[model samples]
Target: MQVRLEQVTKTFAGSKNTQATAVKELDVTIASGKLVGLLGPSGCGKSTTLFMIAGIHDVSEGHIYFGDHDVTALPSDKRGVGIVFQNYALYPHLTVWDNIAFPLLNAKEMKKRLKQRFAELSPPMANFKAYIQRLVEEAAKLVELTAYLDRKPAELSGGQQQRVAIARAIVKNPSILLLDEPLSNLDARLRVQTRDEIKRIQKQTGITTVFVTHDQDEALSICDEVIILKDGVLQQQGPPQEVYDHPANQFVAEFLGSPQINLVGGSIKANKLYLGNEEWFALPESLSDQPVNIGVRYENIRPDRENRKQAFEATVTSIARTGGTSTVQVRLADGQPMRLHRDSDDVLQEGDRVRLYARPRTVYIFNAEGEKILQC
Candidate 1:
């Protein structure tokens, strides 16, 4: 199913009847059978957008569509969206099998809906219970939980319990799968493992999935495309690498990366750009001279002992080594802080004077309004 949100807005009533807008005129199109991530920081309205799509939260304005069908007014159950929440929301008293089959058994007009959806593959009404059992078994097997079919939620590990929740959500074969920070509860290693499993299962099932998350790594690692939101407004939406390489604005550039992009003060004068009073690069003469914020990724800035004509002087303040990668912290002549990533084997001591050179094509310049004015 392809999900589309047209000028959608969500607002909440606070004390004194004040209105707080959660989402503002959000227009997005989620491609069919693709895993799309709604990614942003906390309170950026990512979860709000997901809930609106699931019909759990009502839209204050505009419309939502499942393919060509307008489902703006539909309830969550009526929308045919299966959701797996952050906590898994599994019943501790129920076995895995019962948990997976719960949706099929509890939904209204289950027999009729099942017959309509799985008519060609299903058996007669006399074997309905057997049919439901087969569905539960199939769901469990798909999530690699067939062996734990009789086990309760409390008895399973975090990863296993999450798989059970996923299995339950998919048992009904919903047209759209919605996951709300599904891996936030797991440890780092488990988060990676479970995310890979999610991508694999999504590929096999080809269900249109909307994943809401605040973690950039999870969003970039698994999602086909990511929609970045800030302050209840859409910022940027694109493939992870594309967005990282060519961000639409300063916020989008800074928000997507892991170690985060390094920002420094810069100015353009007479078609020349300067970093901390040191002439660094030349801009197009057609551009006007003005103050600008220069952004460079940690990997884009290289530290060198040998002085270069284009490089700026900086002193090494500290170094943090993580496995094979070393993050070198430096301060410029004017007391501006900057950082760069280098090989852990590189030898550099504190108080060492080093020249910092930024790759031309990787440099990003943003205006005072936080909009990208130049990206080389």
Candidate 2:
């Protein structure tokens, strides 16, 4: 099902009628049968956006549409969306079958939809009891929980419990699936395993899925397109690598990378990019001479064993070892700390001075107001 939001806004009243906007006038269309991710940091309106789609939070203004139906004022029960929360929200004492079947047993919306479906079936079939059993069985199979159907929640591993939660959410065959940080509870290895499983299940189900997460890697890896948010405003939305390479703003460039993008004070003087009096890169003619921030990814900076003259130089401040790669933090001449990506094979210690240069066509120049000037 296709879901679209038009000029959607949500506000909460503070202590004295002062309101805080949790979600601004946001407009996004989730295509039919696609997995889209809502990614951002804490309190960036990602969860608020998901909640509004689920009809748990009413919009302060504007409308929400499920395909052609305007469901702006619909209650949560009537939205036909299944939400799997971070906690997994399973009943400790109930078996997996019971947990997966609970939604089908209690949902009025499901009953209403099933009634409509029943009337449309050929020969006016009356196998209602058998249909529910098929739903439970199918949901379990989707999450690879066919063998653990009789086990309790506590008796299963963390990954198993999460699978049960997913099975429970999808059992009713919701029109749209809302997953809010669904894999945050599992360990690193289990998270990747379950993430792949989710992608597979989503492909088979073909439901419009909205996955909310703060992890950039998770969103980039599992989503077809990622919508980035910051401070109640939609920053950018596109395929992960598209947004990563060509960030719309400084916040997005810094927020999406692993070691974070480096921001250094630079100036465009006489059509040349100047970093602390060194002419390292050239600026485009479209961008006027002005002060700017040079955004460089960690991998774009390389340490030179032979200290080349006329190159941007810095003194090594610290080194952080993470597996095979090392993060070398260096202090520029202006005292600003810059980080470089280096492998373990390089022998560079703290307090060692090294000459470095920015990779060509791999840096971004943003104006003083944090707007993009150009990227080269």
Candidate 3:
């Protein structure tokens, strides 16, 4: 289902006689049958938006729509939405079969209401029963849980239990599926395994899914589109790669990367870009003489041994080797820190003075207010 949040807002009455806004005039759209991510820091309203869409929390203002249906006023049971919680929310006493069948039984009342809504166009009850059974079987197979049908959630591993929960949610064939940090409880290896499993299931089932996560890697890896929020306000929304490559603002640039983008003090003077006391490159004609911040990704900055042009002379402050790559932290002449990603074999000793050059195209320019001024 195509899900849209139109100017939605939510607030909580604080104990100090003030209102705290959980979501601030947020607007987003998820295309039908696609996985979209709501990514942000803790207390940034990502979960609140998901809750609102799932009908678990009422919107303080504005509306929500699933396709053409105005579901803003609907109750959780009436919304035809399925949700997977961080803890999985499965019953320990119930077997996997009962858990997966729970939604189907609960959906009977919903089906009655839906029948009332579309009595003239609705299919017969016999067909609906067959349809629900097929959906349950298909959902269980999608998550590879058919073999564990008789096992209780307590008897399953964390990953298997999670798959059972996913199967339960999907068995109802909800128009929109809301997942709130579903992978947070799994081990590192299982998290990776389940992440791919969720993506594969979404693709094959063509179910519209809204994933809420604070992990940037999780959002970037599995989502087709991403909506970023900060301080309860919408910051940016677009395709995952587009948002990462061309962050709308500095917050996004800093939040979306692993090693984080390096922000160095720079200036545009007489149509030239200067870092510290040396001129790095000639500035574009549109960029006048002004103070600016130069943003460069870790991988884009390379340690140069020969060339000095477009380079920063810095002392290596620290080195972190993580099996596949090493991150070298460098302190510039002005005391600003920057990082470079290199192979594990390409090691550098601390206190060694090195020259680093950043790819021109990978560099970003931000104004005083931290909004991106130049994407390239």
Cα RMSDs, all models: 1.6, 2.1, 2.8
Q: What's the TM-score of each model vs. the native?
A: 0.96, 0.94, 0.92
Best by TM-score: 1
Give model 2's TM-score versus the native structure. Answer: 0.94
lDDT of each: 0.89, 0.88, 0.86
Residue pairs whose backbone atoms clash in candidate 1: 361-376
lDDT of 2 by residue, 10-84 (tens): 999998879999999998989999999999999999999999999999999989999999999999988889999
> Which one wins by TM-score: 2 or 3?
2
Model 2 spans > 4 angstroms off: 118-126, 304-310
Q: Candidate 2 local accuracy as lDDT?
A: 0.88
Q: After superposition on all CA atoms, how large is the RMSD of candidate 2?
A: 2.1
- Badly placed stretches (over 4 Å) of model 3 are 111-135, 305-308, 344-347
- Superposition error at 26 for model 2 (Å): 0.5
Q: Candidates ranked by lDDT, best first?
A: 1, 2, 3
Worst 10 residues of 2 by lDDT: 302-311
